[model samples]
Target: MTILFRLGTAREAFDVSMTRVRGGTGTTGPPPPGRRPERRGHLRRIRADRVLLLVAAPALAYFLFFHYGALFGNVLAFQDYVPFLGVSGSQWVGLAHFERMVTDPLFWNAVKNTLLIAALQLVFFFPAPLALALLLNSIVGDTVRRFVQSVVYLPHFLSWVIVVALFQQVLGGAGVVNGWLSTLGLGGISVIGNPDAYGPLVIAQLIWKECGWATIIFLAALSQVDEQQYEAAALDGAGYWRRLWHVTLPAIRPVIVLLLVLRLGEFLSIGFEQFFLQRPSVGPETGEVLETFVYYTGFANGDFGYAAAVGLFKGVIGVVLIYAANKVAHRLGEQGVYKA
Candidate 1:
């Protein structure tokens, strides 16, 4: 009560002093605008940081030339896009392709597969990295931890083609597992090419390849948690799980929510390379995703306009999902990927 009273009294004194100063200066409103000098100062700072700006030039150019530059090509979505005619020359038939997309059964199938894979990933793959990070954090030996991290992180550097082939060699119908089972007079189980097992298989592959790399962020967050808090919790007779639940998780909750929001933004983009490679084996019915659907429709079927419409639609949904997820994160008192 005393602390609150003192703070209130100090605030009142400051406000009164400010009002007197303003009245004496004959200023009845806010102070004069400082924006012009602020802008000059900002420009001067940028000029001083010219070398640093030079270093960022390549990345700035890459985004400008690729991402923002490509945005103009979304104009193809509303046009009957033709390679020979080009974007400006193409006939503009607004929303026709969008209507076609709504009526297209194949497009709906792709949507279904994309959502299923995304849900599977959210449920199974999302937490795998956090769990692995916790397990790795519990390890006492530096040598063992470094070795395990190196081994796990190596897969993330490998291309999707190599990863898929590695999985096939180990888990496919005629692979090591089936071969061993056959030798033991046990029946072999089909896995790689099976549509029914596609969801679980893809989830497994994603976990194996990306889980370790994903742990990097969580590990960094864990490193920032104060050791004193853990010690205090332990002194209070809290067990490992109890301490983790109370202290560790709260410290890292912001990082987790940030990653979750970012992940939700790209929820439907479950990767084209992996699904495209496996699509032939599992058949399009089970493996088609938005990216691959866009690829096949535009390149294979020569429906460039329709494909662009689908791509634009996907991009819009991604933006909306990110915005909604960020809002939810804000409501839950997390900063998420962006500020409200």
Candidate 2:
């Protein structure tokens, strides 16, 4: 009671002093016309914004639950996780699994495959979407353009199983290529099951599946670019390629860099389902990427602890890579995805 009284007294005194300084009545009339509506306006804004907050609440809750909750699972990396015993009851191994992973030849092989695939993606898959976006941007007809876009984007919606099956139908042994070759008296190309071709195959598949979908973002960014810039470039005697080089590329460079940084961050995630499905036939050497290695470690070999450790390591590496990429972006005078 005494504390409340003292606080109230202090507030009252402060209010009196402020009113005296401002030449306004302490009880408040219209708050000098400027300040009165602000408080009411703030309350009105809160009321209006309440619905938006309520609408977004579910997504916020999902992010908190799934993202933040799964983050805690990283603890298993440092522990000998006994599934039956649960996390709290598990033995603390303190990077034993990490040590084992570094020593394991299979783990090293998986790492090598992942890095090689990532490099391939960076080299080939990265530029394809940008090129597609540029090509799409050149189209003057809306109906024809949308038709092309719909056709291009359709592959992205297809399931990995459907995609892989389609690939097999076209390229697998005894499929269309083999049948065509048999008719022509020529040998078929063994792409599907060939270890030598596996890396290229995955990279090509990733490009085909994701290239069009990835172009959506680039196209969006391209759409925001000023048409007048192109007009000016043309007036200045620039060709289509030159205008694109000087104007269009500059406009979308930030977005490209941002996407590239994000891709760099996910370099290890060559993909789970694709590699997992293909690895069985292609054998471990060509197909055992990090994600599949994790799945096999956990489910196949029943080493949940070790698998979790591997995953945790990958996640940490991802975070570090993203951070490093962002730093590099800043150094290059580029606006990175995540600001430091």
Best by lDDT: 1
lDDT of 2 by residue, 44-161 (tens): 7677679998999999999999999999888888888888999999999997998999799999999999899889988998899899999998999999999999999888888888
Determine the backbone clash count of candidate 2: 0
How well is each residue in 1-340 modelled by candidate 1, as lDDT tens digits? 1112223433343455555545664566675665343445767879867999999999999999999889988999999989999998999998999999888999999999999999998889889999999999888999999999899888888899999999999999879999999999999989989999989999999998889988887888898999999999999999999999999999898768656765775687677898989988898899899989999999999999999999999999977886675455444442222232
What TM-score fits each model?
0.80, 0.77
For model 1, what is the error of residue 262's alpha carbon versus the real structure, in angstroms, after optimal superposition? 2.4
lDDT of 2: 0.80
lDDT (Cα atoms) of all candidates against the true structure: 0.83, 0.80
- The local lDDT score (0 to 100) that residue 190 gets in candidate 1 is 91
